[model samples]
Target: MFNLFKKKANEIACPMDGEVIAITEVNDPVFASKAMGDGFAVEPSNGKVFSPIVGKVTSVFPTKHAIGLLSDSGAEILVHIGINTVDLAGAGFDILVTEGDAVDLTTPLAVVDLEYLKEQEKPVTTMVIWTNSEGKEINVQLGKSNAQTVIGKLK
Candidate 1:
């Protein structure tokens, strides 16, 4: 029964499949400067985006550029779809979840038209940030990432 009741991994999951780049490498100052929190950006290989954790969908930006999640432990993760794609006014994006929805790692958050974004001259660098990462433990791998990959554990 002990093994059955063992705690699940407390790690952040990849919201999309792509190359994971350090937040410091992101072009946006709000993200790169760790202003929002410590996380990474992904140069997405595809258009589909998934939820990074089992949490409550805190907010879905009206522009459809980002989704904010609040984990059970009160951690916040912001998954930004692109760099300044908000200018597109939700044209090239399709949000699959609504605010207050409980989502899991396998839940589809949104679908993006990467080609449209590319044609619009928008950089599809998705950034995932943990907003309150002041003095906590985070151990996420920075490299190639897949949907099921555990980016890192946070405490």
Candidate 2:
């Protein structure tokens, strides 16, 4: 029998160096409750944020606190930086890409001032949520990871 209709899983790389944690474990209620879809979060060890998938930039929030992407395999992802960091009004974030920019796993998304975020008393737990994975399942490996690590897969 010729096998057909088998969908390959799309890999999601880690966007930064950190310990990856389950989406439920994140400190934010909206993301913790899966209200924004399923994904993972990272307690970053540094300040650089990279693209976690091969995608096109769908949105770059005005406050520079989050970025939206449409993956090549059709997963809609939202990468949100910190808890309430948006209130800073783009003070500690440097946007590296604009909307519509094509990006791969290695592409730098933004540069955050970790020290500034700390000084502002913000929780630097970056969340990566799959905003539109209605029927798809995402499985993430929770542990230490770097930008090149394939932390999750969408199937």
- The residue-by-residue lDDT of candidate 2 on 1-155, one tens digit each, is 76463223387988989999999999889999999999999999999999888878999999999999998899999999999998999999999999999988778999999889999999999999999978889998999998757777888
Clashing residue pairs, backbone N/CA/C < 3 A, model 1: 140-151
Give candidate 2 misplaced runs (Cα > 4 Å): 1-9
Error of 1 at 41 (Å): 1.1
lDDT of 1 by residue, 80-99 (tens): 99999989999899999999
Error of 1 at 12 (Å): 0.6
lDDT top scorer: 2
